[model samples]
Target: MTLFEQSGTWRPVDRAAQQVQTLSFEMPEGVTAFRVGLEFDRSGGGVLDLGCDGPHGWVGWSGGERSSVVISEEWSTPGYLPTAVSAAEWHVVVGLHEVPAAGVDYRVVVSRATAADVAAERRAQPAAPPVPERPPGRDLPAVDGMRWLAADFHAHTLHSDGALSIDELAALAVSRGLDVLAVTDHNTTSHHAHLAQVGERYGITLVPGQEVTTDRGHANAFGDIGFVDFRRPGRQWQRDVAERGGILSVNHPLGGDSCWRMELDQPTAVAEIWHSSWHALPVLRNWGGPLAWWLSWGKDTVPIGGSDFHREGSDALPGSPTTWVLCEGQDVLGGVAAGRTAVGVDPQGPVLLRVGDELMALGADGALLSTFEEGRRRIVGDRVVLPAAAGPWWLEDDHRCVLALCL
Candidate 1:
């Protein structure tokens, strides 16, 4: 049965009034399940984000990825959390992400779900794919009991705008030979509940993360810390994450529309200086842009890399430009917090790492090593070690294209 329905035209004036608008409805008694559907003029060149809030608090948000969501006591949509139905006031929140000058018409419908409907929806869910055979692990060396792990600090699943589910994404990461993957869906922690179970099944570590997204900038809050509110300022994100025993990293500071433009009193400890987008151009040119930004922002900021993998063909695959973290065990976040990270073109690509009191250059024969203190030195062999100096070092090919980076 139809519970509530609303239709209206959203103009630029409406968006100017408020980016996010909420409509509320009182739930009738004895309704065990509900579904919310949002429809808008697709060809009108407008973007609308959908989410829900129960009397308790935030339930879920799918940005502009999903148009409809179902919730009940037994199951919920991939991006939503399941909650028991009760007679109370609930809200549908709409974000006017992009509104055309001419305005766009939209409609939102909330309906009651019967048991048969819920059962059929559950039956239609996809099954997990067969696990793929992962490649052999690298034999990179480290100090005493520490080891270097291959990781990618940014990725997504269907919990947000990503194409794959949590299980499918984990399988893909394992197949690409990544030891760790951070699932950073935009503005939501709905995926965190399944990370551990899926990671164990795929034999990979999945770090809990949420991309605190806004029109001005985006940052990744790493750890199992609860949701970092996206509606807050960027500085508050840093403080909130830190106070909760987590770390925050500025993501893709130079990314076109998604760049870091928000003002902050201080910069985060880590920055994604090497992103998969750099692979599209001459490596040195792309690397230099972010390097200059980082130098100006904060020279001491630790550098990291991410593919920002969302779908198969959209972004580079996970582990393309792998992040190598040196840690005692499966503590990728700990390694990142300690500034023990390096980036390579891929899982098996040339790499420069700081081992003990020296530098280790693997698979980087004939490349030039650029460092902060020691200007430049030519690497003669694939496995070459030299006396360490002030770092933020990288290996560049004769064409001036960067092959690897170390922090």
Candidate 2:
């Protein structure tokens, strides 16, 4: 017999990311078995998490790992701990991960059974590996009296969907000659807690980042500042991140299916037009749409690159086309936000930087420069007219291979 059957659509707002919405329902007397479930009806846009807390404390938190869950005295949802369903004001917690400007539409289903034993739900992901000691620092070149720090602004660990541990990722960064790394997990700031200790030991500026992820698009919030909810609108994020002394970037807008579809309400700080995609990125011309998108918002939105390092493979590893930030001290994010940056094809390859009125290609071994619009060819010099490099352009080798791109 049905004990509690209810459903409704929740239209979350800007502050919903840090909120815990609770729907209370009483457990009827003689309830032998209990079950709770949540479902979403949308094509693709944002992300919302699900969990429950009873009179005692947390009962289940499945996140986006599972759609619905069954909870009773015997078992519960995957990634959740089952407990006795006491008769009290039980609470259903909706963990808002992403809520679009149009809001989200959802439903909840809670019911009971006469007699049944719940099956063992899928277990939580293995506990994240213990943080390891910091590795020795690596060497990198200094440019224009300022350090050309090799950094990766987009990466992940087990705190999200990555396979490596925090320490493991750090070790790999060192191998890849990265001077700085940003741990941008899917949607949670839980990884930030371990950054200080681990980053100090690893000798790299481990900038705490959160990938404000949803089906419609994804972005990276860079800094060690406090958590920012992913459920708010994109405009809210740009404003909130800046107010908190952090920077924001639209990530991999040209990625298939995951390409950014969100409208730009404000002029953001950065754009990840060059990601680790073999078919699309700084090394390819498949970024016209996204480049035009950023260009439409004006030059305030600086173009940047990220390896999008999740795990080490041949597709792309950490710091493949390194982002060279010209900064004093350790102001990596500051350099990116200010557009004082350049991207190289590899860690030790040539880089294209805009110095004063000239677009300079340093250490390029005499590579050719060309515009994406095919307007002109700069086949003879390390410096091109600042006018020619205004829009989107690329540096290439003798074989016509794209080395680095700037938008």
Candidate 3:
């Protein structure tokens, strides 16, 4: 069944000069194409610029009103089709000329066009069918024990900037036995439906989120269940995420010259310390020089890592040194909210993770332990200690570098 609906407008609000609107949505799996519609009267006019965020670069142009801008049509952006966007948060910038004329009305619509075969198949299915049973031998241990509970929050796909498809990403997540996967596309949540579809088929939790990126830097928002317009800016959007019960993360705050300096000034749950595929971004040279200084000052902020893979030739890889978050139990959303997430070389690899005083350790076989007491590491034991005090504990692993946190 299709998990997305096409055609919608921005929340009714006043427009002003140099104004920005950010829209957030769950670009579920199975969506192949999408269209965005903007409707606003041309008044109080100067020039209106229209642009939308994409995987690698931004699209559309900020120019006059009354004309429609096709976001993904023909060679809109080089090497990328103006169709089939990855699932994640998306933002559209409607640069108003001279403040919208009083009482002017404008709305934006995003639509997806599916091939006849997929449409026919979709018509044949009732509501999402009962998930197919898993093949034998696939019955594995709890994902938390296998260190599959943690995963990278930032990544891309062929839908936009990344090279892989939604199905491929899910396969990787499932093969890794990830309990939760956050599909963060560049600027649009078009791929979310596909993530959710494949995730359910594979028995995993696919959280909806977006990478609110700008020419300056990028940020990610997880746990969102509805359409969030990242196109609208200000604390209201941040507040909207909180109101919707989502986790907000500032991505790769230390990346480069274009990196956003404001993440340091705002309050957020986590930050991306390691974003792989940096070599592909020649435009932003010296991306790592200032990261160390920023990290030193923001040690208190949670650290999450990702491959930041977009497609091939893009500045991210499928699993090149990604991150993971270890949740003690289900409720993936809760884990992210509690800062029980981790991003390192490989979250699924056998390793231990220590965040501040809190720690979590994973065994080569995927067993997990939480502790803070400095003592001999325990392995293959039946008895596990629960925290007696009110604070985070250590996550340990004998093999990999303390992979992630257990909050």
Instruction: Give the worst 10-residue stretch by lDDT in candidate 2.
Output: 119-128
**Model 1, stretches more than 4 Å misplaced?**
281-287, 372-374
Q: Scored by CA lDDT, what does every candidate get?
A: 0.87, 0.68, 0.50
Q: Write the per-residue lDDT of candidate 1 for residues 188-235, one digit (tens) a residue.
A: 888999999999999999999988888788898999998787877887
Comparison by lDDT, 1 against 2, better one? 1
Question: Per-residue lDDT of 317-403 in model 3, one digit per residue for the tens?
Answer: 444444555466556666556555554345334444443443434443444344334453444533233323432333334432333
**Order the candidates by TM-score, highest first — what do you get?**
1, 2, 3
RMSD of each candidate? 1.8, 8.3, 12.4
Clashing pairs in 1: none
Deviation from truth (RMSD, Å), model 2: 8.3
189 Cα displacement, candidate 1 (Å):
1.2
Sort by lDDT, best first.
1, 2, 3
Best by lDDT: 1
- Lowest lDDT 10-mer window, candidate 3? 72-81
